[model samples]
Target: MQDIAREAGVSSKTVSRVSNGSDSVRPATRDMVLAVMDRLGYRPNFAARALKRGRFKAIGVAMFDIVATGNLLTLEGITKAASDLDYAVTITMMGKGQQRSLAAVVERMKNLPVDGVIVILEQMLPDVGTFVPPAGMEVLLVTSAQSTTMSTIDEDQYGCSTMVTNYFLDRGHRTVHFVSGPEESLDSHFREQGWIDALARRGVVAPPVIRGDWSADSGFNAGLELAHVKDCTAIYAANDNEAYGVMQGLAAAGKRVPDDVSVIGVDDVLRNLIPRLTLTSVKMNFGAVGRRAFRMVARAIEDPQRSRPTRELIPGVLVERSSVRDLTR
Candidate 1:
């Protein structure tokens, strides 16, 4: 520190302030000190800093799958927010099926050297009672279920699902059919419930849900079946990939979108590639969920006793496009 200060012709205090990112230092002096440090290849000792601050300056994120579009986007948001807050994120992916349990994952994360932890719920856990966090460990959840023990952040899946379905029903469609995600997914659960609730409110019975594995291929198969159902005029898919596959299947079956049938989906993905398709979708603010989760975890870490369990719901908006036909028009 003193060497850099001497070389930059500044006091040691000025160099220290610059290195610590303090705004008290003059801009020119801070620039000069940074240049000197860069030229000298000076690196701050993270271990020493952590010891002094009593924090690892890092957070751990545990998830079952990272390849899913929604999970990937949420992770991106987490990474961005953590970087902005000067915290590092360590990601751990738990394998699918019986390879791991929620209790096991929570225990493993407790052993890690992170100041806090965020759990991304990709599937329904067997028992929520067994997934308790250790004392003093800050924890957050991103799931559809309302949590009473930890801070939870999620997109309002039920409301968005109902909104899209109601949009179709109001357009003179007798009823809205659904393409659902995996049976074990909480998102699929809430979205399907929302669809059913919307129909029930209108005194109409909902059609049997067509199940998909969150893949375009599964949606294609479901679409093939719906194509044959002459009364299936409106379809609401759980996500955008499924909607794309449904569109392809409809085209192959000699059905025209918004003419013979209208299609709507959640997750406005791949909009640039298929602009002509103009698929209407429910757009989720996944970035907001991630940022809020991080903030909650940070608060817990700062004062665990004062931080109470809170639920944050990020709402999705309906993006209008050419996919759905307005029969009233």
Candidate 2:
């Protein structure tokens, strides 16, 4: 510190402020100190800092799977939020069951230098009761499931599902068929329940749901089955990938979208990749959920006394496109 301070023509205190990213230091002085440090190959001792302050200025994020689109987007949001708050993030991917247990993962995160941890819930973490955090470890769960023990931030899956189902119903479709995601997913369950509730409200008998693995291939397979059902006019896919597959299957079966089988999906991801399809989907702000989850973790870390377990739900909006056809018109 003294060498860098002398080299930059600044006091040791000024060097300390610059190293800590204090805004009180003038921009030019900060830059000069940074340049001197770079020239000297100086790196801040995070371990010592953590030991002194009882914080690492870092957070750990654990996910059961990283391949899902929703998880990917949520992670993006988390990193952005963490960066904005000047905190570092360490990510850990837990492999499939028995391969890596939640207990083991939590232990690993506890060993990390992070002050708080955020766990992105998946099939593995279905029962929060089974998992417990280390002492004084602040934890947040990003999931649709309700949890009384941990803070949670999730997208309004049920409400969005109802909106899409009602969207098809209002278009004069007798009933909307559903292509659900994997059975184990809480998100899929919520969406499926919403579809059922929507149908029940209109006194319409809900059709059998076609199950998918949250994949375009699964959707295509479900779509092929729907093609065989003559009365299948409107379809609500759990996600965009499934909807895309359904479109393919319908096309292969000589079914025209909107004109023959109207389709809607959740998670507006398909529009960005398949612009020509013009898919009408429920737009979920997974990014916002991620950001909020990070903020909650930060609060828990910074002010543990005031931080309480809270559940926050992010709403979804229906993005209209050319996929649904109005029969009443």
TM per prediction: 0.89, 0.92
Q: Give the poorly placed runs of model 2, Cα more than 4 Å off.
A: 10-13, 23-28, 97-102, 124-127, 130-132
Per-residue accuracy of model 2 over 127-221 as CA lDDT, tens digit each: 47666566678888887776667788899988898888888889899999999999988899989999999899999988998989999999999
Tens digit of per-residue lDDT, candidate 1, span 64-143: 88988888889889999889888899999887554566677777776777888888987777755446677767778898
- As a whole number from 0 to 100, the lDDT of residue 174 in candidate 2 is 93
Misplaced by over 4 Å in model 1 are 1-36, 97-99, 127-130
Any residue pairs clashing in model 1, and if so which?
none
Clashes of each: 0, 0
TM-score, predicted candidate 1 vs. hidden true structure: 0.89
What clash count does candidate 1 reach?
A: 0
